[model samples]
Target chain A: MAENQKLCPMFEFAFELLGKRWTGLIIRVLLDGPKRFKEISAMIPGMSDKMLTERFKELEAAGILTRNIYPETPVRIEYELTDKGRALKPAMDKVQDWAETWLTPPDQNNGE
Target chain B: MAENQKLCPMFEFAFELLGKRWTGLIIRVLLDGPKRFKEISAMIPGMSDKMLTERFKELEAAGILTRNIYPETPVRIEYELTDKGRALKPAMDKVQDWAETWLTPPDQNNGE
Candidate 1:
């Protein structure tokens, strides 16, 4: 049906947030637990600090995650998912499953 | 754990493909059925023909979908997903479920 062909607005919105470079990896890292900026950057090797900072702002603005500042000898900053972001586990899990099933073994080199 | 913090390569590859703008939407549209370039462009409002064309090339190269050309008076062409792409239904479904649950309703205008 023609109606079925049209992309759902909500799905579009979801992808708009999720379908950015390093967003999924950032969320995936946070899904485990709160981590500081350096920690997240370290987890994802290719992602630059600037991109991580940009994604953090977007995710925070989207209500998917929150930035926490802890007062200590030196203030510590951490990024953690909100309930909404935590709920993305099932979806993220599904993506991981699909990746395992369809993606080639990581060891095998396929010329990019 | 430090080990757990590292991003999985397979997951990273999958997101690299899916995280690009309009990739998910294009795949989602094809999941319904095969359609021509014009049909796909029409279905997704605001997506220019150039974008759809680019995504089609990438998806084809990835072995996710194939382009079939029918030798007819008009030389009809259509694009369909391969098994690998079709297998993404579960992951896509999960994303849709998450969107329905967590994303704000389409009706409410939130300043972008």
Candidate 2:
């Protein structure tokens, strides 16, 4: 807030994690529940598979989400939020609230 | 959340506005109060003047903030968040809360 008051490095770090393109949308989808790779990809229309895969690895390495592998006849993989990831719900909700309040629907912007 | 449930275009738009590098920090600084250009730039380290100027224009165009010119000997200018920008406080606070809870202090992570 002040020139003398240092910005929290942790807050900066959080942005570094969540503020990238497609990252927030990925988290928003997961907020519903655990999703398979295809499921996650399906919900976000524009994200490339390569970017999604990279984000998955980053979230995994950061301990936000876990990848679970099922040893069925064909292996089934599910991605679920860790405790750390679930803790992000409140923040995500706030963003959603703000978005709903301020942003217009893309389709309705013909007049703009 | 569901694959069938379309992601809100508004949310995507909000992210498009806020998710850029240095944008959040600029908003965070202004959340304290209105500030002159130098004051805002002073608060955020490592941000170039050019980038700050660019973000300021973008924010103004988005109606997130306003630029006020005071007619003095030398024109005094200040940037203030509009109601739209002020509405972002709750969301920013939530992020700050999550960051404090989850992210390690930068200096303490020497072992990592």
Candidate 3:
């Protein structure tokens, strides 16, 4: 398994990373634009500060999001999706459409 | 958070379910067509039988796939994606495109 993993490009790794607990929501928030730590946490309703910080680091490592630190009074830090990360937009849009079209209200799912 | 979650459609649940370990592979396997238990298991290189069974049941519950029992010489069970499951094709295609174009071989990621 380990040997074969290298032969492949590791899409599963990307899928699994994004698939992690609150990571999808985190990506969605970033898709709109770059956001500070607190702003990201606010967009996602129940996510914790610890989880948010952890996810940011993890995504940064994965090359999905970039963390930029600004030189200022208090030093502003923001996270933004990279080109690879932005590539996920179409897929995410499809999911949102699926959710709005089929997963909303359960009853509305069969409306089509 | 709970109350707010109810107000919004649960896209996260669907994303999380598909995002689960081996679940994305499972969905991808089913994308071609219905398959028997072993067939689905074969496509995913290292997933455990226990985990595959669990994902199938979970996806079935989520209305992503339907289970059918065929009464022939012996008894056979096959799983196929529902309309909702089929609806995921566009998104999955985007992911696969991203994988092949941007995620493949790492070096070829910047192929564009």
lDDT of 3 by residue, A1-112 (tens): 3433442335555555656778777887788899899897887777799999898889888788998899998999999999989988887677667766677674444455
Segments in model 1 whose C-alpha atoms lie over 4 Å from true places: A1-10, A37-51, A105-112, B1-13, B19-22, B37-50, B72-74, B109-112
Models sorted by TM-score, best on top: 2, 3, 1
Q: Local distance difference test, per candidate?
A: 0.80, 0.79, 0.74
RMSD of each: 4.9, 4.0, 4.7
Quality of candidate 3's docking, in CAPRI categories?
acceptable
Candidate 3 per-residue lDDT, tens place, B1-112, comes to: 3533453336566566666667666776788899999887777768789998898889888889999999977899999999999898786666666665566664444456
In model 2 chain B, the worst 10-residue window by lDDT is B1-10
Off by more than 4 A, model 3: A1-9, A106-112, B1-9, B41-48, B105-112
**Which candidate achieves the best lDDT against the true structure?**
1
Model 2 spans > 4 angstroms off: A1-9, A42-51, A106-112, B1-9, B109-112
lDDT (10s digit) by residue, model 2, range B58-97? 9999889999999998999999999999999898788778
lDDT of 1: 0.80
List model 1 lDDT by residue over B3-110, tens digit each.
Answer: 323336566567667767778788888999999999988878767999999999999998899999999998999999999999988887888788777875667577
Who wins the TM-score comparison?
2
